[model samples]
Each structure stands twice: as C-alpha cells, then as structure tokens.
Target: MKGHRGSILDIAVVADGQNVISSGQDGTARLWDSAQGACIAVVDDSYSPINAIAVAEVGNAVNLGSPKETPSNREVGTEGKLVVLAREDKSLEGVSLHSRQSVFDFEGSDAFNCCTFISSVGVLAGGLDGNIIHVDITNPKSAVETVSWSETPVLSLVPFRDTYVASYGNGTCYIPLKGSEQVLQLTGPNRQPVFQVAAWKKLVYTCCRDGFIRKYEIPDLG
Candidate 1:
C-alpha cells in the first residue's frame, strides 16, 4: 500500500468492499486491504506511470491469454473480475483480480487518460490525443478501432446504457450512440473543461472546471 513513488491516480473498491486496487504515477498497480490498510499484492509494474483504473466483472469474457507480467505471490485472490489500468505509456493493461496475472497489455494511439468497461467482452480507453480506443477482450490482439471528434485530450469515459458519454479537455461532453455513430454535445453554461460525467435515470450530470455541476435531460436514454 505504500510502494508508489508518485501520486496514486485512482483507486477502486472491490465488489465485496473489503479490498481496493490502485494505479499510480509510480508505475505500479497495487491491491490493498480497505479496512486494515495493508498491501495485499503488487498486481503489476509497467515502469510507466498509470493514470486511471477501472474494475469490471468480466467472467469468461476475458481471453486470459499469455501473461505479460504475473504477480510474485498469490495472497490476493481473483474475484471473477479484471482490473484495467490506463497508463502514461499509451498502454492499457488488464489483470485478473484474484490470480493477479496479466490478462492483456494493449497500446493505444496516445497515452490513455481514462478507461471503462463497455461490456463483458469489450473495453474502452480514451487517450491524450482525443481518441476513444475500443478493445475486444476476447480478441484483444486484433486491430483496435478508434473514435475521435476533436484534437483535445479526452478526460473521461462514462458508460451510459448502450453507449458511452465522454468528456474532453476542450470542455465538450459527447454522447456517441452505439449503432448510429451520432454524437450529441451536452451544452453547459461555459466552455470550461468538463472533468467527469454521471447519469441517473434519464438525467446526465457533468462536473466542470467552471466550478459548477451541470445537468442535462436525456429523454430517450432511459
């Protein structure tokens, strides 16, 4: 729990709420005991700073191909989930929760700033170059597809039903429809960068640099 040489970028609690996983700018992904504040395992070390982490219950959808890096010990158990790390090296890493084994390490168009699980078999990462890279976990080595609307860095990726709501450094919030490829912008009071997004029922909310939380009504996304 104390190994990161740089700032810890993100931390995710397990479904059981007893454990947490963290990614840091120090280039290590660590597992920790939430209650005891003990380090359980060092999940991976890429020698490159990690920017974000997301936990998803992937089950059998992950390919679990040849591990690129495996944990040194087995004290941390696998939890029928995978830990995805967004790294500054332009790579996205997936490691099994319990086994602490590498599931995959995928490089993207630019350093990834954020990532999220789109489905059981699919993952999405947004990069500094404004590209949203999609990965099929079951066929991870295949050519990855990208989506971009501008040249500004992507700051966040939030899953919303069948599509994803992404935010950019240029203060734009985009909701890209899955099939239609239609992009809808959520207008705010100003152009200050939208940092993150959350949705409840048919309403979408975004936090911005303008020191305001903006809300948008999505009548059809319910």
Candidate 2:
C-alpha cells in the first residue's frame, strides 16, 4: 500500500499493525490505513522536511513479572505515548501521536537529521553538525549532552538492547551504554551513505544508499 508521490523520508508501522505513518520531504506527516492504503490524517509542519519518524508505546511505569518467571514468560503491555521527530528549522521537534500536538521543540546550532527513543533512558538525536544529544522526556526542557563524534554527520540512529548503533557516510559506529569509547565500527560498501539501521533478534541490519540491505551478526560484548 503505497501512495506517496514525493520522496518518503521515513515510515513506521504502528504497534497494533493496523496503520502506517510516513513522513515525507513534502513537509507533511501522514497516517494511512494499512488495509486500504488510504490517507487518514495529515499533520502539516512546513518548517523543514520531516526526515525521521519513531512510534513508541508510552504509559504508566509498571513491571508485571515474577522472579520465578523465565525470560519468555514475561508479558508485554501497552504504553499510550507515540513520539514523532522531525527536522525543522535546522533543529528537531517532537510531538505526541495521541494528541497530534507538539510536546517539545529543541533548537541547536546545526541541522538535526535523526532521532530515536531508547526505551527508558531518553531520546537520542543525531545532528548534521556532528553531535549526538540526549533529551530526557521526563523533563521536557532539559537537553542532556551524552556523547559527541566530530567530523561526522550522523545520518541514522537505531537503539539495540542497551546500546545505540549510528551510521554516517563513511561507516557505522556502535556506542555502548556505559562507555564513552566507540565499541565497533562496521564500514559500509564503498563509503555509501547509510540511510537506516534496525536491530532484530541477534542481528543488526543496515540499509544503505547503494540500494542494499546488509545484515551483520551482533557481537557479544561481554
């Protein structure tokens, strides 16, 4: 189900698998019905092109598991919050999907390219100015400077387990949760731009601008 005429910057499927949300270079974010492939809602933000989109389950903090329960026996519940990030006016803006309203807007000196939600830690943003900023959603007004990698414009960011995997034009860098040093760097094909990265099971996958999706086995950093 595809109807976007302009370039699709980013797309995300809802947790329920009933709808798909897409952000485009046309300065709009659209929610579409997955079954019929029809546009249901259009969020107009003409600040800049919406470069990335992320949907997360938000709800009251609760732990529903017993000590005797095994890893596979845990039950996952729903969180009500959905976070959407956009590249606006050389910065990043975040909004809530439930209210379809702006939650908070962050302005930086450089152009913000991408962002991702890291479970309970915070929101991580990568900038074209070679900086990675972490924002605590619990405190909407604070900008926490987590780590920085100079001379590289981080184009994509994906969180896996407790670490974050970011990609640039030169290669990909893996940042551990507790270490300041880079854990790993996997070079892309011939310096192609890494557009997106995803982590599933025990493997990490990268989609490059060269039109190839490559998968790598995630190493055990023990």
Candidate 3:
C-alpha cells in the first residue's frame, strides 16, 4: 500500500492471494505481502505510466520466456504465471512472473486502459479509442481480433463464460460472443462511466462513476 511513489492505478492478487501485485503511475510494478503489507519486490519498470495490470496462473498455457539469471529467493508465487501491463504509451506487454522480463510487447491504436486474460492463451486489451484488441500469446505480433462497440474509451473488462464483458467511459457495457459478431449490452448507468466489472456464476457486476455498484442477473447464453 505504501511502496508506490506515485498513484497506484491497478492491482491483482497472486500466489492464491498471499501476495498482491500493483501498477503505479511512477512506472513500476511491485509485489507485496498480503498479510504483512510489506513490499516484496519491484517486479517491473516501464518508461510510461502503467495504467493497469492483471495476473494469471498460466502453467504451460503460453511461453513466458526464460529468466536470464537465477530468480531471487524472495520471489514467491512468481513462477508459472504471467502479468499483462496496460500502459499509457499505446503499448500492451506481457511479462513472465518468474523472470519479470517482458515476453511480448505489442502496439496499440491508443493508450491501453485495461487488460485481462480471457483464456490460457487469449488476452484482451482495451484501448482509449474503445478498441478491444485480442491477442494470442503464441502469436502476439498481430491482433487476433479488434472490436469497437463505441468510440468511448474502454474503462474495464471482465471475462464471463464463453464471452467477456467490457465497460466504457460512455457508461456502456457489452458482452461480445466468441466466433460471432453479435454483442449484448448491459444497461442502467445513465451516462456515468462504468469503472469496473466482475463476473461470478453467470452474474455480472459493474462499478460506476455515479457512486453505485450495479449487479446484473444474466440469462442462459446457450
């Protein structure tokens, strides 16, 4: 909580919640001891402000490059995982948790606002331009897909079953189905930006700028 020199932008839990990883406006990503609230390690550094981050346990799901040196003994729950950084400089990068080295860096149309891993090898990075660019970790040079439901900057993303939910600055949220062009919208926020979203048991929840959290009971998608 106190190690970041600048404002903390986003955070993710790692090591099954024993530790927390945070991204800061100071351009650093740090790991922390959850119970002790102590800074564990400065995991990464970026030239641009890291706007968001997400961690995933991706054992053999994708190739997170080997570390050049022996990993520090203090690094706990860092192996066999990956961290995705959404930066303010129109770049989205993937880093190996164990190595803390960038595995892939891809260019985005605009500054990335948020990111999340939808599957073992599939990643979704939403940009300021409202473009949600999908990347395949195995082949990150090119975008697997990019969709823009609206021109407003994307605010958040949450992976749902077989599809993912995206929230936007314009107070719009959508669920885009895989292998199809159709999308479902989550309505209610009346022009207030939907800041974040989370999914559980087919239910979706949104945190809005209007100082209220909304929950949606989704119907059967099959």
Best by lDDT: 3
Q: Which residue pairs in model 3 clash with each other?
A: none
Q: Predictions ranked by lDDT, top down?
A: 3, 1, 2
**On residues 1-222, what C-alpha lDDT tens digit does candidate 1 reach at each position?**
587888999888777677788888889988887777778778788789989998888877765444445543433335578989999998888888776678888878789999988888789899999998999877778545888987899998888878889999999989986567688888873668888888876788999998999888885743
Q: After superposition, how far is residue 217 of candidate 2 from its true place, in Å?
A: 2.0
Angstrom error at residue 17, model 3: 1.2
For each candidate, what is the lDDT?
0.82, 0.67, 0.89
Let me know the TM-score candidate 2 reaches against the reference structure.
0.80
lDDT of 2 by residue, 1-222 (tens): 455557888887776766677888777777777766777666445647888877676553222112232221111121255555657456566555544566567776576788888875378888887677787666656687646655578888888877778887666555564564646766556777787788886788888878889988876754
The TM-score between candidate 1 and the true structure equals: 0.89
In model 2, which runs have C-alpha deviations exceeding 4 angstroms? Answer: 1-5, 60-79, 177-182, 210-212
If both were scored by lDDT, which would come out higher, candidate 2 or candidate 3? 3
Global Cα lDDT for candidate 2? 0.67
What TM-score do all the candidates reach, one by one?
A: 0.89, 0.80, 0.94
RMSD to the true structure for each prediction, in A, is 3.0, 8.0, 1.5
For model 1, how many clashes?
2
Q: Write the per-residue lDDT of candidate 3 for residues 147-173, one digit (tens) a residue.
A: 899999999988899889999999999
Superposed model 1: Cα runs more than 4 Å off? 63-77
